[model samples]
Target: MVISFLSALLILAGLVFFLGAGVGILRFPDFFSRMHAAGKGDTLSTLLIIAGFALYQMRDLGDSEASVSAVLVALKMLVIIAFLYIASATSTSALAEAGWEDGNDPVIAPKHENRLAGPPESRTAAADLNRNSTHDSQP
Candidate 1:
């Protein structure tokens, strides 16, 4: 019961991170910001959710065939977690690099500045302007 409850709690926390990532991707002004959200949130959420399931799988650990199978499944989950950690980071970096090479500029603002605190043109529009300049400069 305790294991199940803990697993559920972890899964829910993971879901919250997933929600945060979704909102960040939608609300962020540019490519690099969205990638930051997706990369960090997606990686952490996946890890948390998988860890929960792995914990749940250990609920049956004992001297029996079912226990052995549970252990195997937990190990498999661990492998998946490891693979995702590497793959997600690699893919995020690759995509970000591709966007940078394609002349997508990030939305840079002052520290502790609200995104909406600035004039509208100073927000994403500025990023667009920068991107255009970079694009024009490219041969």
Candidate 2:
């Protein structure tokens, strides 16, 4: 009974994490931010869910005929969890790095007329034209 309850809680927690990740991915401003949401959320949830399943599988550990298969399955789940635990962060970092290398800028704030006219360095690429013009005019 206790094992089942704990497993259910873990599964629910994983589902909740996934839900939050979905919302974050949809609401976040840019690629890196969305990837952050996806990477952290999905990885944790997957670990929790798999761990819960593995624990639940322990219920059959005492059955002589099924014990070997049950242990094997639980080990497989653990291996998967370990693999994902390593892969998720690296993959997210890789994607974010790729985006950075490709020159994808993060959205710092909402687009508006005032923001457009704000500090020069904070301005978007479109405003870069005005900066270059002064240099071009000198030569």
Candidate 3:
């Protein structure tokens, strides 16, 4: 009972983080901010969810008879969590760096008219201008 409760809690927490990441991706003003939210939230949430699963797998563990299969499965989940922890961060960093190198600039807040509050057309125009500028500079 206790193990199940804890597992549920962890999974729920992970879900909450995932929701936050989705919101960040939609609401954040710039690429870097979105990426930051995605990378951090995804890594942490994934670790939490996997850990919860591992713990739930071993819920039957007791003093007398131990399940070898359960232990092995938990260990495998742990290994996956570890790999994801490293790989997710590395990949996010690489993507962000590539965007930077490709001339993606962070949105700076100005005192006057907020770019974020502007219309979709204006935003697309700005993006188009940036894309055109990058192309013009190349070759």
Candidate 4:
């Protein structure tokens, strides 16, 4: 009974994190922020949920007939959780780097610009401005 309650608690906590991730993905203004929410929340929630499952599986371990298989199942869940932690972090970083390299800029409020003017121009436009300024300076 105690094991079941603890398992439920962990699973519920994981679900709450998952809900937060969903809201962040929907509400964050930029890709990186959304990815941050997804990666962090996904890794932590997966770990918690799987850990709860592993703990719950062990509840049957006291039974001689089910001990070995229950132990093995719990071990497998643990391994999965470990792999997910590494993979989620690595993938999130890689994706964020790729987006940056591809010129996806974060939304920064311009000091003098009116709020209703919408976001600044695209990265290509900025790059063009730089090139034009460099050419003007050279000659």
Off by over 4 Å in 1: 110-139
Candidate 1 collision pairs: none
Q: TM-score of every model?
A: 0.77, 0.75, 0.77, 0.79
Model 4: runs farther than 4 Å from truth? 112-139
Highest TM-score against the true fold, candidate:
4
Show the colliding residue pairs in model 4: none
State the lDDT of candidate 2 residue by residue for 40-68, as single tens digits: 88888889899889989887677698788
Per-residue error at 52 for model 1, in Å? 0.7
Using TM-score as the yardstick, the better of models 1 and 4 is 4
lDDT of 1 by residue, 31-71 (tens): 98999999999999999999999999998676578898899
Q: Is candidate 2 or candidate 3 better by lDDT?
A: 3
Residue 104 error, candidate 3, Å: 0.7
True lDDT of residue 139, candidate 3 = 97
Displacement of residue 132 (Cα, Å) in model 3 is 25
lDDT of each: 0.89, 0.83, 0.87, 0.84
Clashing pairs in 2: none
Q: Scored by Cα lDDT, where does model 4 land?
A: 0.84
lDDT of 3 by residue, 30-129 (tens): 8889999999998899999989999999898774456788899999999999999899999999999998778676787665554433654666697787
